[model samples]
Target: MSARTTLRARWQRLAEPTLVRRSVVSVLLAFVLVWGVLLCYIFMTYKHTITNDPGLQKYGDALLVSLQDVTNPAHAAAAIDSTETWTYIRRRQIGIFPGKTLHALSDADGNPVFASHELKTLNLPPRHPEAVGVITEAIAEGTVYRIYTGHNARWALQVFEPKRTDAAFLAYNGRFILPYLLLAMPFVLVPVWLSVRNGLKPLQQLASRIARRNNDDLQPVGFDAQHRELKPLEQSLDTLLARMRQKVERERAFVQDAAHEIRTPLAVITAQAHVMARSQSEAERTQAQAHLEQAIARTSHLAQQLLDLAALDEAQRPTPRDLDVAQWLRAALAQAAPRAMARQIELSLDAPDSLTTRLDLPALESVVHNLLDNAVRYSLAGGTVAVGLRVDDGGTTLQLAVQDDGPGIPAAEQGKVFERFYRGPGHAASSGSHNDAGHATNGSGLGLAIVRQAALRMGGQVRLGQGLGGRGVGFFVEIPLAARRG
Candidate 1:
């Protein structure tokens, strides 16, 4: 293959949907979504917990105690400035400390005594001291702060840090969280991939078993599926195999029967040819020629019947078209008129002036021709052969019946008449006899089989019954009108 073709094939394979790919993708998406939700939950919880840091209150209390011991205003200011400088230096040196803190000292009258550099420009208000340190939120110049207040008898001290924004927190902490999440993914995905592969192992094995089977091995698969999901697949495969086996058996039987039926005519033709070649007089040659012709005719008829049966078996459902069935029946009778006349059999049709319906024309033609041929072949000379077509079952079904005044099949043999190449007990002797027209009355024993199969193909059925005057045989074919009507 060309490079482009190979690439295209690969792309198509990837594009095709597969169960394993779908399952793995679904699991991966769920994993990512769950991880995202967990991250959000952790961020919210940590934000709430850090807002009331206990260590901030302790720092505030210590600052207040230092301020109480300094009575001089300059010394008090110096003490506050010293504390702020120390906090700044420690924050810069230690990674664990807050990134920024602002401090302010106030007297008992709530006047600001001193303020750190960052807080100096802003107006600072003192909070009322509580017995226990209290943490609260305050907003100054559009910046939110988490504030802790502490007080002694003389001085109240305030220390606060700017509350971290969501974006700031993410930037600061994402590096640590993201690496760990990345590290954990392979651990999770490896197990998931293994589980999915193992889960589908049974399906793969089933496919391998099917692939290993030979074409002639139409037996049901023997694999004992352990999974609930695999049972339906196994059953369906077995059912298909069973059907195939039946079809193979039927084909084998048909071939055997066809060979057996053709052999007799072939042998007769061979013998007659030998006789003609060896004949010394014109009469002997003529007799041999006649016999040869008869064998050829029988062989041709049998071949045609075989072809008709095979067509019925192999052809797909035919498309239906509007057909005047009554008119069609008359035409069929006209075509069969020569054979009927030669046998001195009177052919009659009983149908409406105009009966139109949708039908599969070829199937209908096969049915009518086979029935007429069978009737004419079996009916005695001077016998009446009748053809009938009518809409019955309140116009829902079309009934076609052909009857002949000849020897009818016995009740015991009637059921077997439709079998392929099956002739009655005395049919062989009768088949060799000639009619008044010097034409052999041989029957291929396939006419009724063809009729039955053709009727079935048209969604109809054929049944044998009493003929005209109740003395001979009749074939009644009933087809559903509703099924084929346009």
Candidate 2:
């Protein structure tokens, strides 16, 4: 690129405007421009008033009187220095510096008669009608002269500043003014820049605080700012941080509980495997291998329940749809048939297939499956697990109940059972399986918790009560009818 283009690009880069630069530059540029205009206005406003000055007027009047005696403008010029008319002016103590003053006379017809010695040397122009003073304008460049005219239309008397002295006078004044204008720039801009920077200091401090935080530090922001705007920002950030902290705590607690629950089964599995590996007799080895298989089955069951609970916590709720509760209960109970048979617990459903409402399919299915599993896991051999669906409250509400002949949750301990990883006093099992191959089962304590979560996700509530004939525990779920139409 050419030098001009290169310089232009560099200047453009430097001038790419930011908030601070625009604010400072706009303020300073406006101040300088306004001050410059003000100075120019005051300098020009009544400047011609200087021509009405008594000291300079006296010179023109005296010179005019001296020229009247000589009618021709040329005799007037010769008489000033060549004749005694010059001596008359010395007697009145009138001072005239020839280098600094000019004299000229012209007839009423506009013909020049006489002029001073320097009049021809000075090329001063005449004043136009719009010019503001008795003197022609003071020149700004080259050689400047103030041309003064005294005229009555019949005769004219003109005096000009002799050696462009106006240039020297203006130059002297400019030297005094220019430096001050240059100095004003920094004074105007520095304060503006500083004020803008200071105004954004709180935001800068907020950014620094955020940047310095540890990755796991989800605690609320703690900076106290003087600015009210930052208060809202701080509050919003703190709210999000508080939520994040809670989520992290929940995750930590969940991991601890899962590890504790899974540890027992894994230990049993490892011990049985070791026994099988070390056994000398064939029958002993076979028994140990059977125990290992049972441990493996229990471990798989525990892991599946853990995953189910985790998924419920993380799953986005599916859109609810109008669904037949009796139909869903039948389907869920059918899925639990194998486990129910393995435990020797009979599963049955009571209600017409027409009993229906709106709820999410997976969530409702999860709730029913957990309830059925709990019933089967805790019930006696050949015990009946009855699932029922009905319409309540003038048919505007749906009611679902799962009751069994299993050992029921006592009334006092019922509320606590829904808590995650909660194992009530009488809730222990002999072994850990729903299959016939394993003797007994100890639940992971997440079944009812999952049921409760699923119920809430479907916008319903669950109640704990006695089973048929008050023989065992029952979980009754109630749902709104409006949710279906909505």
Candidate 3:
């Protein structure tokens, strides 16, 4: 393949739906979602811990003890100025805490003795001392603070630290967690992709087997499907191949039969032409001309029937409509009237005035025409051919029958009469003089075959039996009302 074509094929394959891709995408999404929720929960828990820091209360208690011994208010204020614990608290204002911290000292009446530089500038009112060791949150100057207060009879002390914001927490921690997730992704995804690919191996093998088959080979695939999910696909493909083989065989047989049947009439036509050219008398020329005409008529009839059979083979399902069957039958008889009159044969229909039913028009027409042709052709001069149409008493099926008062087919040969191009013992093309009806007696033998096939296509069946007066043959076709409606 050219580079462009190869690239296009690769892109199409990637765009196609695959189990491996779906599995990998689903796993990756779930992994990221779970990790995100866990990180959020951890961040919230850490914030809660910092808001209630127990170590801040300890520092407050120590500051209160340092001021307890100084009776003079100036001495009390001076003691906090030089306390190492206070100095350590001052250093942490810019050190351990993410934001600033503040400290305050007050007497029992809430007069401020000392305040950190930032806290003193704010000029905030003294907070009422809570129960010793209690922590509370306060908002001032648009900043939230977690405050710890401690008090004795001599003094009240407070410590404050600003609460950290969510953005600051994520910025500090994401650098560590994101790398771990990226490092873990390949380990999780690679094995999942491999497992999905291995599970689909059987389907790939089945496709490869189909691709390797020759065009003429309609045999079933030999690959044994071990997976339960793949068995139905294998069976369906085999069923389709079997049907294709059957259709091919039928077409081959039809072609061979048509070629064989047409050869005899063609040879006769060629021979008759030669005889007419060589004839010396008017009587001889007339006989040669007559023979040539008969051969041509027979060949024409055979060709028409061949076309009809081929068309029936390829026809789709019929579309049925409501039709007055009795009226239709009478019209068919009128069309066949001249042919019947040629042989002095009488055509009659025995039916009700208006028998309406749903039926496939073309299929019904084919069945009627072929059946009438056979009955009229086979009957002797002055004989009667009867056509009957009626619905059964229950009205579920319509029955059509045609019979002739002539030499009937023997019981032994009746079964073979419907085969294509099948002529009985006395009906051969060379024995045209046996019956008074010249071309009528020498049939192409496709009428009954066409009748049976047309009937079958209409979801009906044909039966062979005794004709009128129990002397000649009869063909009965039965079609179901329910099937016709469909």
Candidate 4:
């Protein structure tokens, strides 16, 4: 492919769900996290202003005291007009009061002091008899007070700050700060964003390096992340790559080993066939033919095992369906019947009248066939091999078992039996007959391995032990009933 095409493909791969999910989650979390911190800072400033304003509190208190002295007319008027308190009052008034008008209650005659505009709007009784009661109670309660009222209503104290001035102050601040803020934002955002992007540069480089790799290249990821925070992530990715590389190497080795094993039998068969054709004596020809047949059988068995391994390696999940366990067990018995008869071994079925299970057809077939073959192949001639199928625990468990009169495996070696290519200790002694003529040895090991893989794929387990009816090996499989489907 062209370089441009390869680059495009790499970009597409980077758009995979894993990368997209990580990027979106990181950005969203960062936004919420930063905004949350800023909001907390603003809340702290608000609390400090309201709580620590001693000067403002004192002014409010003095205003309340003045409002309480209503009996002395001269003192009340002087208090109302007192220039000594004007600085305190104006500033406090500007800070606390938002409306265009406020009210002052005189202690002398219960009169009100207000602006001219307020007076024109509110022509009330000499004493604002309506406010006298409310203001008296409010002052007595010592609440740093504010009241909301219309222009036509009489109030205790009235102060007005021009709306134009308030608007101008806000507009002036906004105008003065806007250019600088606009200019500073790029500086702030650019550096932080660049720093963040730069910090993430190693990740991008690592991705690019990974992208450049061929399908067969599962080598460790190569990148020197500069930041401490990125090191752990790089290390994890490196570990993952190492594991993947090791798995690929193991699979390659297995394929090579299988090919070598198969090739030997095929070469022997070819040689034996050539010898049979050239043999002049009937006896020699017959022996050569027999050897050729054995070699062909071994080759065929090896081929079958390779195919089974390939099938078992497929990652696709099986489509499970409910099946009658008794019926399936009967079928499994029928499959084993031929091998049993060849050895004159009696095969018997002990399935209940009706039982059901959830299973994938092909996978379940492999499981049954392998277990039955293992049982019949290992059993002594004239031995009885019994198959059983039943439901237990209100149909939650569908159990299938096959038992044969053969030497059982040791308990300690049971775990190792499931491993690929693992041959039991007494496999040679257990073979019982050289009539094993046209069959496989390695095939036995592969059969059990395939059985385990299939059982696990169907969310089930298989176990080996002494038979329920005999002192020989019993192969049993269990699948959860819930997986069953109509």
Candidate 5:
């Protein structure tokens, strides 16, 4: 597809319930609602008007009586058309009996009345068959007939108003009604538009603000809105901005610190290499070589820290694999065994045979390794570091906790430990005084930060507290349980 066509399609997809659709649907719904109410009002008004019209009801009843009197066989047929008799009735009853016709009846005693032969084509008897049927039914039911019957011989009375001459009355109704409907249409349109515009104002403002934002605009969105519904949206957007700002700031600080750290080690290596070049004694050469090795180790440690940070950032979803949490923790403990031995810390594992948590193995392994590594590094010789696993509520998660019997963190500082490059006072103390060249080292202090990030990516949480015996810090990681393997 052409670029323009593609763009149009994308916009069309996004524009469902657009301004046009909203306005149209709103107006149509308003029209229907108004029309329905008008219909009900007209119906009620017409019923009431008809009921209250004393002249119309009185005249109609008189006309029906005249027609009934004419239908009787006892009143012998005059040579004159019954239409002439109707004239007398109509003038007397305010034109109610305009005119009528007569048909011979089935019963010798009864005659039929109608205005035209067209009406007789319906094959209705002298009286309506339905009316006669009702009288017969009443007699069978042992109920009194409310309709005129018995001596009247079941003659029917049907009334009709002339459509041509009465057109003026209908025209008069429209004359009063049409102008009102037209005038009220604009009034309805204005309010519906205004209410919708008012309702969408905050969203419009939000869109405008977002559209105007540049990459450098990290300021939080202000909440000077008058609407209550908009307040939640404003607060949520501000929260998102605050989080994004913190992430950017952390990344920037990490870069600056990493550069400074790498530069120092390189400076040390360069200075040592220059000294080794000028040295003439065996002792000087040995000292220079040892300094160079320390610089190389520091550079390697910095590189590892950078790698861990990237891994944590990249972690979003876990690969589909059955990860045994207990087994992974055991493997991590075994890897940290040497470090724990050097620190004279006891590595204790308390796990089920095949406890599993749903996660990517590599990312999950990093979480386990980092926590245990930190625990062993900080603990005093002969102190115990324990790792344990248990299932959570709903049987849907595996909770892993690593505890060390070293100096515990103060409650006030527990929250800050998870921040990147933040190290507890206990770890800093033992880091500088250790004996083994590789084992004594502390890299960029991102171990706990990595653990927290990994936990978040795995849909888990990391909490810090005192150890099982309240001796040192406890690092807890909780993850959802894996699916059953077939």
Candidate 6:
């Protein structure tokens, strides 16, 4: 391949994604940019360095000293080699010749009165009269010279030296400086790769530590980072681990609680079934069968409650839309109104027309159903169980208050009501609120728990206070309006 083609191909590989390659290439590129600029500068100043040489400038001055001190212009020719200046120029052996006199001295009339034997052989043009300082000129193949010219009252002084000495000097620097730089390249590039690996040490350690962990270990990494870029990553891992650990603990506790809750009804069922099977008389069998049916019903209720909890735990809520909440609430109330009327309690719903808001319909439906059911079942005959929706915060929030004129719960018990399967004092058999036929309604005590969870999922809170002129309990739910999604 051509040299240019090879270099171009090598240049394109600098962009490869391997870290070691990038690091080594970057270091080499920086060195090349600086070295190229320095090479250009050295060649550009080659002439200046030669003309300004202390030795060359001093030799020229010494040769011209005689012309300046001569008593007459015509007699100045005798000053040639009089100060032994020619011997000084020849002693340096600067050019191709060891003893070449390479300049000519002339008068103001352009007549060469004293000329070096070698200088006359070139047959070159005379120096410009106005050119007063040192300059450079090309003499022949592979030959260049630094020419110095000066004048006094009588004679013009010229001194010349070949530039081979300057080339030799530049080459000297190239030989001593360049090769070591190339040889030391490994020292430079090796350190770059080492630094990249060193910078990534914390990350490698983090991965190994996590990979080696047992499945049950959900603890935070807890490792501090030395680099600023890694700190945020460390914190994020710690946060995720903390959340996972907490979730695991919650799941463990929930399984235990659910098992306990379901076990009681199931045990009752098994015992009642055995009793029904053992009964000999028809009347005794009928009575035992009734008990068995009730036990089965209770177990069924417990299973349904567990299913609801499971759904609430896993269901990803959809983005809320403009819901005619008033309409949905009325539809929800229609289902409860018949149940309330059976107990002679009035079920009433009040809201503005269409009352649009963002809400997950199923979750919100659960909240409505649970709160209203509790209200109707607990209220006294002929008492009012009112469901209401009030828009506030300039339409940014919607408040739902389910107020009933039942015997209100004590302030201390209000907080505990939202707990799973938690039943308050006088909330069961002794309470006036029961299903028709006056038998106490056997509840799983999950109604208000479901209500609280649903409210929280909607970014809201449930507050218990006085209802219906401070005569009974009021459960107030407040939720933020759902943000519009594109």
Leading candidate by lDDT: 1
Assess every candidate by TM-score.
Answer: 0.64, 0.52, 0.63, 0.59, 0.66, 0.60
Indicate the TM-score of model 5.
0.66
Q: What total of clashing residue pairs does each candidate reach?
A: 0, 7, 0, 12, 2, 0
Score residue 82 of candidate 6 by CA lDDT: 49
lDDT of 3 by residue, 146-212 (tens): 7877888978887786766677666656555778888888898898899889988998998888999
Q: List, residue by residue over 244-304, the lDDT tens digit for candidate 4.
A: 8887886887677677777777888888788888878899888988888877776787678
Residue by residue across 322-408, what tens digits does model 2's lDDT show? 776776677777888998898787887888856556667777777878887777876777788888887765767778898876556
**Runs off by more than 4 Å, candidate 4:** 1-118, 121-128, 135-253, 272-297, 391-398, 407-419, 422-430, 433-444, 467-471, 480-486
Candidate 2 weakest lDDT stretch, 10 residues: 431-440
Decide which is better by TM-score, 3 or 4: 3
lDDT of 4: 0.62
Better of 1 and 3 by TM-score: 1
Error of 6 at 218 (Å): 3.0
Residues 1-486 of candidate 5 have per-residue lDDT tens digits of: 999999999998978676645785778676657655765576567656644653333443554445454544344233123543664576557533223322232223344423444344433323444543232211112222122121233343332222212344444554556677768877877777777777887799898988899987778986577888888888888899998898789789988877876787889899999889999988998999999998898789768867977977973565757666677777778888988788778888887788754567766877887787677766677888888887866787768888877766767667677776654454453542111122323455677777888887777888876685767778888876556331
Cα error of candidate 6 at position 159, Å? 25
**Tens-digit lDDT string for candidate 1 (247-338):** 89978988887898789889989999999999899998999899899999988988988999999997597788899999889999999999
Top candidate by TM-score: 5
Off by over 4 Å in 1: 1-18, 29-196, 394-396, 428-441, 482-486
Clashing pairs in 2: 73-113, 73-114, 74-113, 431-440, 431-441, 432-440, 432-441
- Residue 323, model 6: Cα distance from true site in angstroms: 2.5
Poorest 10 consecutive residues by lDDT, candidate 5: 136-145
> What is the C-alpha local distance difference test score of candidate 5?
0.63
Best of the two (2, 3) by lDDT: 3
